[model samples]
Target chain A: MKIRALALALGVAASGAVSAAGEVEVLHWWTSGGEAAALNVLKDDLSSKGVSWADMPVAGGGGESAMTVLRARVTSNNAPTAAQMLGYDILDWGKQGAAADLNAVAAKEGWDAVVPAALQNFAKHDGKWISAPVNVHSTNWVWANKAIFDELGLSAPINFDELVATLEAIKKAGYTPLAHGGQAWQEATIFDSVVLATGGVGFYRKALVDLDADALGSDTMKTVFDRMAILRSYVDDNFSGRDWNLASAMVIEKKAGMQIMGDWAKGEFLNAGQKPGDDFMCFRFPGTSGAVTFNSDQFMMFKVGSDRRDAQNQLASSIMAPSFQSAFNVVKGSVPARTDVSDADFDACGKKGMRDLASANANNTLLGSLAHGHAAPASVKNAMYDVITAHFNGEYSSADAVSELVAAVDAAK
Target chain B: MSQKWWQQQLPKLVLSPSFALVLFFVYGFILYTGYLSFTDSRMFPSNELVGFANYEKLFALRHWKIAITNLGIFGGLYIGICLVLGLMLAIFLDQKIRGEGVLRPIYLYPMALSFIVTGTAWKWFLDPGIGVEQIVQSWGYTDFEFRWIKDRTMAIYCIVIAGVWQTSGFVMAMFLAGLRGIDGEIMKAARVDGASSVQLYRRIIIPMLRPIFLSAFVVLAHMAIKSYDLVIALTNGGPGRATELPATFMYSYTFTRNQMGVGATSAMVMLMTIAAIIVPYLYSELKGSKKS
Candidate 1:
């Protein structure tokens, strides 16, 4: 019934043009406040090119449910034109040869020169472009309330020691030093960044990304767990089941000093009409500023009939275009996927993200985020999440947690 | 003879489609799920058989243990509370009370709402920052606190509370029906014997409602095992897997985490758990009927 209603509405909106040209039916889970606005950029871009978009917006936060729907649709041989996928999920679909060959669009757009290699790796399957890169979201970011920071005469922490000191001072000032949500994914988000901060980018990759037993069970990993415990201690009793945005709201209201979250939390600040660098300060999670943990949101085009292939091409071109990339990522609270896109209108935090991303890219320090499905497969990442969150919740000691991580990753592998 | 045969065949013909649907979709799928439990499936189903490897892994995970522990806590509390409440309400309404017709519907109304709705409403009502805690604090009781939904140790109780709220009324209706079916002559005789109202219930009425209790237990036990949406909306097995149940674990593993084998194993375990409760009850029911 909902599908019929949507089709009827699309038919009315299209009138004669849909049959004249082709329609792009994009399946995604970008229905939140800021996410919706950002998605309109891609929609309007396609519309400007005489292509119609049949919006199939599934409104799950993490797109996990959307992937289930997509899998069923594909198995039924009625795949959508495109779907919003992350990291190896795109590759997973590509391995099935379910995604389209977008080399036609890629060659025309000079994507090889423009799109980042890291994003391109997942977008390509067997050396063929199957998806279009949209934006880069670095997960290891700390959003601090500038008001609280200034009142306390503190700067953003430069290391784990400094971060602890800053948090202690924030606690002394009688504030939630670290605003946190108690969900598994939220806990893993903090752990992902903490992995980078505790060890350098190399250690983060070896342990989290590669599931290395030596790195996972080492004393360094134990200290990472210790730091995680310290971070957990800073949260209040009311923190469980709290939405990530609400945690961001704590920083927005100056009730909390800092939030360890992805760049997407900027949307909450933006929604609250708070400007970055003025109302808040954005930095890489302490000791990890030099590196970036990235997860790119890519739209994988599916194999549609010849009739709608033109619309798919139009979508690919529009999405890959520098102007739309800038416009979309600006609203999407992510940096542009294109390295060459100008950061002129980007906010202070956005500029920092762009600069850090470029430097990380140059220095080979850009690692994919585990919580957001960039570093490992879903099974391995979820295993790590179980261990990480269980440890974070005090189900295991730091050493036990480290050993459990090794066992979990090994079992999943 | 032809006319009689045609009339008899018509009912079977009318029911065949639904019966076939139930057989193939329900029972057939169960067998298929059983098969998948033994295979090495992930992200998508596969043909590779791994014997009981998935089940072994599923049992070893700490999260799975936590999920089972939560189920025990939730299921026990949910069933115990609902049964007691339902019995009490049935007794209250059975006393030739005023506006019984009006009151019965009020009691059963919560059963009409989906657990999702019940959960979301209760989530708001129980969450510390925005629910009762915040409301009470705002009312000048600044030290007042209610954070059970957020507390790892107590989060499962919040689910139990919501589950009972949605289901106790249904249990009440079942008991009420059971009460109405009781012979009025027995109650009159008990009254003549100088039995108190409480004694009448304790000695005769309650014991007579055994079948109703059994039926309610089976229903509630199945619901407790399959408690997914309520948990999802209430805590989503969160505050670090504190409220995780087998159903939610099965879903997250199969769909979200792409560990379909472990998920199927969990599903099989849940099916066995539910079957263990229901099969014997069904056998006794059928055997008793046959004996009669």
Candidate 2:
């Protein structure tokens, strides 16, 4: 009888231990220095909460390969507990019933109030929250070496004409005016800046967001193409095939005048021991200061069986918690998705991003970054990639490129 | 009677695991992918039927056009150059010259490398700034430009060059085997008739390599149809979609673009094309063999 009682006690202990050690596998493409650093906050928090993290990182900028792995796992009924998703993917996957409905967890944590409206829209399917947004990335920022500008007696260009003159001046001084990476994504980033710079914020919304045919073929788009032709002159001859971080390195070393990239380039600068405002400057590309092109990285929880759902809820609550938002974004080199989160630990550039994000959110200047998977379907995005890259390589005439772009969108539809 | 039945079925039972693997991994996956082509799936498999909508997009994209065009250019050049060069190398090596053993190993070593490693080395050698162009410029041949990999029209040929470097050795080995199989009496007659080296090879030996030629043709054609890794690693279908192949196009559509339906359709199209060519040729070869 005593032995039977001991076995029952041990059974209870084993069941309790099992409940405490639920392991969650997270799949993401955040292998870069800053990205990994940011991911550690969540890892550390999860560990502190007695949850184990099985980290699966796939190294690719595009995140397509990781999505492939995620889909395969889901199809095999072995999906990861959570995965990194972007833009419409939350809705896209949620609609397919691949994502777990986080409504109960969200209500318990009051996630609706903390998370931004735009992000919540993307994260929800039929008003049910399915994903947790991590941070906001603004894609139209132009990073410049402050030392180069100071040494050359130049200031940040505030308009299209001034920006052109600045680029010309930088070139005449024998420095490459643009430290541009020649990847398709980087080229598209430059194009996004061009569109906003030439056409202003409203046109970007109409053409890119709404996919308005007349807006796409407007004289505004022609101006954008023309400016791209000019911007081409600022890049070095051997810019093709250069990685984005390498381009950032050029700016960090003051070898080139500027690089038009997303806010993520700040991480590269920070890694090089360069502080913002002292060594470099971040500003929206000249004529695009009033516009904000944005893409977000969100962590989406998948539907596991009931036993692990509680652990998933705990992580979701931690993600939306104010403390985690601040800590994660400070390391991530991005602004926290929560507007109310403190930017105390943020650097000068990050603080600027926070201020800009708030203002953009308030003023309705937030445009989605198409190439980075916010504005269009993947088919339309890839079609645009082909035409834009072809045009950049000088293989297509402006007229030819415009026609192809329109045709590609129609075909994509 | 039961023991006899067990013994009769033992070999089949023992090999069942491998047969099951082949059925599932090869044929089952192929059918699954074909079924996926008919659906309007994105990010995850959806049962929404969109019936050839994806294929319509694949054909409409300019990058797809460039990929199909590049396949033709690279496929023809790679096979033609590798076959001719491999035959010449095999013939020369068969002369029983000194150091033949060492040279043969050297030729075959390239076939052992992963395309990723080979592509990196090739990219460095072909880079406009750091490669042949730089070396020539340093040597005061300022006008000597080797920028074929950078040139949009000629980038596909650059992939062909890399392909020959990798595969010519294998082809040489095949031709070498074919050459060794020739009867000694034919060479004796050729020498007695005072046939030159070129005349003997062109007239007699070339005709004798018919079976080897057919085998090599099929192997090369299969390689061309499924070429992906080399293009991905080397040019990444770049210089603005100038060096894309059908396989890479299918990969990007299925994986990168998340347009699985389109990707699946392209795969089916590629499979059908291969079937159309290979089925008839294989049938004719089998018939010819039977007649012999």
Candidate 3:
């Protein structure tokens, strides 16, 4: 009986390998509760089209480990059908001729008319579409516990000074003024808004996006560091090594007044069974109202053999479908990548995000976030992380941080 | 004649596949990485040789500097503490104490766990709000403070604490084996010659355990040098890169930061450091064994 079972297993494996025609291997980093559910929407859509999904989840928050695995797979001549990539990384792969051109599918699906230009910049390389963007994650939003603000009789602060005063009020109420994770990326996320608030969108583009030495070393950058220092004082002593979701939980639990993070934090609040407008509130980081610092999640298709090309194209088209984008982004706590998607099914925060994104795109205030690998290349982003984290941790003063920022960016370039 | 040749070549034939695999995968990759270090590689390997520019850039990086400094502090404290603690435990166990078998396994159990588990456990245990500090506070000691893991300057010491906690047990086992291997006759002779317990250990037993000490040092030193997962699990080289080490730096640069050339350069430097330690020890051991 055992011998028979072994023979059957081997025969099944052999047939499985022979029948691996319609399988699409998707490498992604969305393993969190909401994120996993969000990805399932796409998986089910692809599966419905008779294309099997071979899920390759690498669970780093920043998709760093996924990129690492993707590079290894590419180098070994066994690239996945598609890899969930971010800004700059997609173009980097496209430049290396590793990504498969998706212009044929993209044109057929009219993706150019639907997807936002900011996202399209990452989706295309050399006038050919190589990827499909899924969602837009704006990093300048602050999630606050509405109860705490109501009890303290404090409203949302609209500028830097008022924000400081509100934090003081929250501290006086004996709550953690700011819920912040001490990780480098989290610190840099806060810095993204702080830079925008301090110097406006043009200066942010100059200092971070353009890697300008003059803007980076100017007094404006020094003032940005000073404001960062103020934020550092508001964080709790136990903030070190904490994850961003835990920081979000602080606000949700009413132990903290607010947390300055991306829209992804909204997922945490929703996961905790809390309603957005009732239990919590979402607002742009003060003085960053008109500007949206954004990062879009894009799935860059890798060059694969003709046997799997049809399935890969199916996956690309499914990712760009308006229905799939709305369904996925509603659960993902991010706005849909497609501009034509309706906000009727979205909750309060989601609707606001859609409105803000549309307005920001029209006004050309939609800047790529430096913290989220959209403003610059990975090298420059990491360099900025080093300086910003150091400054936030009080290792460097405002003056030292400005000079170090300029030097670090230059060295990275 | 054919049967005789087959028998003579059996061991060589059996070992050749593994030997070839090791040579290609280990040494071949090492040489490849060394070559990549000289090139202008980023995100992926490239053949454009930039010659020593990556090395210059690496040395000038503040992150690299902090990583090196942290390695020194972490490696020194981890190895030193483990040695002292391991020696004490082994000597204590060497005494004809009751339940030696039970105590031995209890101490050695930590060694069975991966550094990742040890690091995570220690991270929670050392965290201020959740672990020791809270536990102490709940015990009515509100003024108690044990937040070293959260502090910038003192976070590296927390890594040393966790690393020593995990590895000292294995080192203790090594020392205990060495102690058991010591000839009973020499110990008896020393005792009969009016040697006290302290003198017996300090002057005779410890002097004879020099080889064990050397072995333990070599083992602990390499573990300290390549400690990536432990640092990652504990502080993640954070609280502002205060606990960054070379291994973590190499990984972040090569994979995450898109600075593969600098990463390879860091890796080569680390390899040289390990070689600087291990080559001399290996030569001495081989020479000493040959003489014996």
Measured by lDDT, the strongest candidate is 3
Second chain TM-score per prediction?
0.95, 0.93, 0.98
Residue A176 of model 2: what lDDT?
Answer: 89
| Candidate 3 local lDDT, B193-253, one digit each (tens) | 9999999999998888899989999998888889999999999998988899999999999
Candidate 1 residue lDDT tens string, B234-268: 98887777889999999999898888889999999
| lDDT over C-alpha atoms for residue A69 of model 1 | 95
Q: Which ten contiguous residues of candidate 3 chain A have the minimum total lDDT?
A: A12-21
True contacts kept of 3: 0.85
lDDT of 2 at B121: 83
Predicted complexes: DockQ each: 0.74, 0.63, 0.77
* TM-score for chain B in model 2: 0.93
What are the clashing pairs of model 3? none
What local lDDT score does residue A279 receive in model 3, on the 0 to 100 scale? 94
Interface RMSD of each: 1.3, 1.6, 0.7
| Model 2 misplaced regions, further than 4 Å | A1-21, B2-8, B46-57, B140-143
Q: Where's the lowest-lDDT run of ten residues in candidate 2 chain A?
A: A14-23
